[model samples]
Target: MTRQILLLSVMSLWALCGATHVKADHYRLEFPGMDNVLPIASRPANASRIFYAVMFDAGSTGTRIHVYTFIQKQQGELPILDNEMFQSVKPGLSAFADTPEMGGDTVRQLLKVAKRTVPRLEWKRTPVVLRATAGLRLLPEQKAQALLEQVREVFDESPFFVPNNSVSIMDGTNEGILAWVTVNFLTGHLYSDSKNTVGILDLGGGSTQITFLPRSKKTIEAAPADHVAKFDMFNTTYELYTHSYLGNGLKAARLAALGALGAEGLEWQVFSSSCLPRKFREDWSFGGVTYKISGVVDGYTGFKPCYEEMLKVVQGIVHQPQELKGSSVFYAFSYYFDRAVDAGLIDGTQGGMVEVRDFRKRAKEVCNKMSKLRTVSPFLCMDMTYITCLLKEGFGFKESTVLQLTKKVNNVETSWALGATFDHLRNLNIH
Candidate 1:
């Protein structure tokens, strides 16, 4: 019952949000007169009523569209999440940094998916928003804004409702918070006073996030001020420990590990690492830039050197939360799950649990046998080692700490998009 009321409240808040453009930089929901909000029972129940929301996840590596359909079975109750239509395209919007219109074209192509998923009659009423993640955040300010302006023009041209500030770069903190909301909400752990909520580790291409409801007050007090956030929902205030580490994402880490992050001379420079197969060399493109990467043919190639190189990227860079070493359930997703799958550490379809040491174990095996594993990605060794180092050293998780690797929950993509959608609706659209 509490969860239901919360969901209804979420719907109310979403409605209020539609009235204006929603900035994704900070999530501070302040609902005035929330105490006197009408009960769901007071409103007319429309069992056949349905609504849809369209969210665009502009990430470092790809751009995705999520179309959510909700059914209001009765008043004063949470609407049923009927289904989601999702699609994605590679080389994310950031790839078009030099060509803003081309980036908008990608969004235009994805909007076709939304057009087909949503009913024609509901087109004008449906809210469409695009939120860029670390990908855009990593770009130059002018370039990022240019890309956003292009997307804004596209949104305005579309039949959907284009709210103000609909296209913008999301704040790293809010990214973590929304993703936490997504996982907890899907797991049925969003109830008031619920202590069973799980923490989330999201490893995107250009950034990463760690968010959880701290069980100890010391966790909050010890954390950096920006690491903690408080928001009101369901008439309850939640203070969560969350932070997004920009430039620490999988792809970005690879660049940093190769010593090619922000360096020039990409055309003549060769970024080499001991993590790759001894003979491996390739031109990799990430976030609209290309880098020449290779393994040191004359140097040693194995886990030790690779782990050492990765250490420079993780050690002392990531914060160590005091409570993380204690008993806490965590869900690791995005690149954490992807790299685990690539390394054959877990089943791709059915995600499973593994300890922090499991990643280390796999990193060793993959790094030691790079020559024999021709079918695997050349960066597999580095990626695995990075995950291992990031977990054990970056965040200071115990080797035995168990992490649930999941790609989806209840058939919906486990990301901040849904949570952002819910937030978008709560603001109430006045049309």
Candidate 2:
């Protein structure tokens, strides 16, 4: 009886030891937000085993994938391991529709390259997060749904199998908010700082978003009962106002320009480069010099007409109706046109000017003309009441404040790219 008891005790001890070994090797992976891919991996040979988590930002014009490693000492904060970025011409929606697996295939190609470079990574345990941005959101609802379903199907076939809980599609509003937040955080314009509230204008390739945040004041008093309340502003707090205008990017600019010119029975010669539109390529002569216009047709209804139209749009969106009446309008298109000339695509002195001048000189001439028209136009003084209402509704700002924030630009990038806003949001932890 004693020998039998000893044998049983020995078996029980071995079982417990094996269990401990298995538990010690276990690890967990996490991904935040639905729009990104998270990749996780383990390094077995190192003295202190390391695990990595990666996220991919799949945008319409480019793809950015950032890898991060879990730091146990830092309470699992994932630090960047490797960041990769690639830009491609916008792909057609039909392409993704026909091959749902293409999205996964593209991801796999990227991962394959990453893994090959980092040979120590354990492929079996890696978890990847994939998120699509403007490209997916621009699609019609049925098309977007189909595209997502295809992405899921392909992602499942990857070497690193995704658990059922590992994937999601971010809602459009959330994506817009997060993108707005990210830009705000990076530009030092987040409302968390008790300085003057900053207004943000973001012009993307397909859409534009305008946001406003209330300035934080440092002179506070009582502690809130809820911890979250410290950051929360009650109804008394200044709120963020945002306006997202759809179909207003470069492509839209071209379409609107074409529509306007078509009504007038005029057509500008098209340029070979996809970036340059037909109307902008028309040959023009001034002061005995002929010049070829480059860059996308900047605004609808031609230069002067479009400028007036935009002013009305801006006036309507501002808080004070009269503030913009005589304000200086800054032209943003000059830079874009200057770049095109620098690239040697167009000649500015073809009409036989005595001296050949750079693109800047030509752009300056164009801007001067537009500015003169804005100053002299009789129709420029119309009431901006409608625009003011839009500004109030879109950005949640008082009508007066909206008027104060109104500014004009000749180009979209200089006026309202979302990069700055994205930065601000990151700092505020909205991303």
Candidate 3:
């Protein structure tokens, strides 16, 4: 059996996802102080065997549980994932800010799935964790804390092993890196002998993230200090460029483009835009707040007007990568996959890849369609236009950039949750 050593990396993301370290087959997590927690079980007289972990993602749109089952191939080596039982509940934990107990109940409900997935005898040995993202981070400090406290209580009542700082909000920066790790890991980029790794573009409801190992020295030298990060992994140190833009996701970007973000009163001013149906008017909810938004009742609307409005939301906000335009591969998921599916650009179950110009071409079609009549999504025009501008004007990508649109790779979810869980097992050194 080949031996592997999992060591501590950089500590910047610890504020978001906490920190973990391992030595001599013993795990030590500092930020959460997970000392004396569930150690690798030696019950069967073999330190190498099966193990289970439960991860809950309390995201802006929903709360999801990934009950991961793994088999330790050998001592001091990475565990092989046997299976993952995934399930989710809607409205997100942030929606229950005013009713925290209900938020706790949602967690308790998901724990039932964990209870069934993980064998009863292994219950006491399995560790369960929950990490909230942009949703809770957007809430008032008090409300977010209340919701977290509620989840902690729920975790305590469960039979599974719960660690210190079991529930908390994740940093936007870490979110990007984790997503990058997940895609690269699933695609075998981490295991191959190639010097390249695929980039990741995640568009969530409240935030969007971009991460990639920069091939250009200029990308690292000329970029903002905060955007460049270095971490140790795979027995080597890696320097990457990553960042998460808050309030720039598909949903939040709508509020921003509509001029409703941080607005004083919801009903005082009804935000009207050219991206909506001419007679469309409705109230939308996001991050626990509601707003009255509509489209112009009588005026011109189409790709031209919509693109102009969407441009304001991302014209100068996004920082372009120094070298992605030439010969780089990227995987764009979440809202990217969904919107492409909605626009008939790709299928939901079998997500197909698309070039950067493809999004532009589709955005024009969707926007022009909206200008004439209603399409499948009322927000289709705005969403597509935002993605288009966000990639081109915002991120400085050329229309030729190729982005592989996918929800899963190798039958595993290509989400940050997978990378987040890999943290617990230690990012394995690929043989």
Q: Pick the candidate with the highest lDDT.
A: 1
Which 10-residue window in model 1 sums to the lowest lDDT? 34-43
The whole-model C-alpha lDDT of candidate 1 against the native structure comes to: 0.83
Candidate 1 vs candidate 3: the lDDT winner is 1
On the 0 to 100 scale, the lDDT of residue 148 in model 2 is: 64
- Quote each prediction's TM-score: 0.89, 0.46, 0.88
Q: Can you give the lDDT of residue 318 in candidate 1?
A: 89
Error at 259, model 2, angstroms: 4.1
Show model 3 residue runs off by greater than 4 Å: 1-37, 40-42, 46-48, 74-78, 192-194, 371-375, 427-431
- Candidate lDDT values, in order: 0.83, 0.34, 0.78
Q: Where is model 2 more than 4 Å wrong at Cα? A: 1-51, 62-64, 68-104, 113-126, 161-169, 180-200, 216-239, 256-302, 308-431
Best-first order by lDDT: 1, 3, 2
Q: What CA root-mean-square deviation does each model show from the true structure?
A: 6.6, 17.0, 6.0
True-vs-predicted CA distance for residue 348, candidate 3, Å: 1.2
Q: Give the TM-score of candidate 3.
A: 0.88
Question: CA shift at 415, candidate 1, in angstroms?
Answer: 0.5
